[model samples]
Target: MPFWRHPSPSLQPLSLLLLLGTLPLLCSAATPGQLPAKRIQPLPASNLGSGRVETKGPGLYELTAERRAALETIRYAEGTWKGGSSIGYRILYGGGTFNSFERHPDTVVVKRYASAAAGAYQFLPGTWEAATRSLGLSGFGPASQDQAALHLIERRGALAELDRGVLTDQAINRLAQEWASFPTASGGSAYGQPSKSVEQLRAFHRESLRRHQLRREGAPA
Candidate 1:
């Protein structure tokens, strides 16, 4: 008889039974205390890693380099401290009436102290109109306000100094005169006007400039 031979049917059944018995233990040992947890998949990248982001709001738009710098200037100059808060439509007041610019048909008000500047950049009616006209923008919405302020920033040529983070006393004073709520180079607001301290203004400018740079570097705005 040949030494090599098939296992008997009974032996085959026993081997199969042993394998079935070890299957559960093998699986448990492979997985430890619990089964492997499922992982969530991340969102697929769009346009081959372009990293484009979609945002919502009034001022939300394509943030070009120029637009980012313009927005930074506005934040430093106008968003710091105005009327106990940042400049907005809510700040527009004159003689206790809302929207002094609207109350009077003419942009010029007979009483300078009677009116509170309006918009994010705190522009008077006359100044706002002039800036808007130059920029070919119309309306009092957030986009229009931002565009108008950008024009003023360009006209003043303050973007360079803002970019350099080296604003001179003369330069700050010139801007302070335009925005009553802004402090002079000496950290003093215009005569008979409220303004943030120089230290606060510096902090704001630095932070805004840093953020603007980060945004330009592909960080979210």
Candidate 2:
């Protein structure tokens, strides 16, 4: 048998270059039924537009594109109309925070209104209590208020239609009962002092739908 010896040290660099050159081809080769290993990449940052990123955990974020769309939609339809987080109707009506228990003086249906309409959405006391208790919501933060409003929309069975941009007048009328700003079938206030006309509500909703579609389709805001 011939004696085996190590290669010369001068050849080591050339040997390393050849091995490195073949390494890629070796790694790229796979069984007939298998695929080559894919390069793992960290996730790209979310494009949630102008909304601020809300941290949910140590590394988790909540400001996604879909979330921004929903928040914007609600802001236009509810927050903008009711009084935004700042200087919204809830505050003037003596209702802006969860702890707000002040009664609105406006009367509806010949009865003196007593429930507090608090939060950006202007949730009535009974409505907020029922919703929060049923949904197990801990507080009335922006996220919680968003969830509660969306939950009400889901209950009305209009969420799917709204998302699809096919909500009808009838659906809108029905949903309007859930909000005082919108007119009812009889064109009367469900709650006292609904300042917005039906035409205004319709226009707002139409614009909202258009904006929603724009965002969903990746068009400019």
lDDT of 2 by residue, 1-221 (tens): 11122342111232444455421111000111122222222212232222343433232224434433433444454444442344343332233233332332222111122223455565654555555554544445555555556556555555656555544566556556565555557774443443356566556656655665687689975
lDDT of 1: 0.43
Model 1 TM-score is 0.51
| Residue 127's lDDT in candidate 1 | 61
C-alpha positional error of residue 63 in candidate 1 after TM-score superposition, expressed in Å: 5.9
Residue-level lDDT tens digits of model 1 in 34-118: 2232222221223112212233323222445545444544444444234323234333333222343222122222232223245
How far out, in Å, is residue 71 in model 2? 7.3
Candidate 2 deviant stretches above 4 angstroms:
1-115
- Residue 145 displacement in candidate 1 (angstroms): 1.2
lDDT of 1 at 33: 13
Q: RMSD for each model, in Å, please?
A: 32.0, 28.0
Q: What are the Cα lDDT values of the candidates?
A: 0.43, 0.43
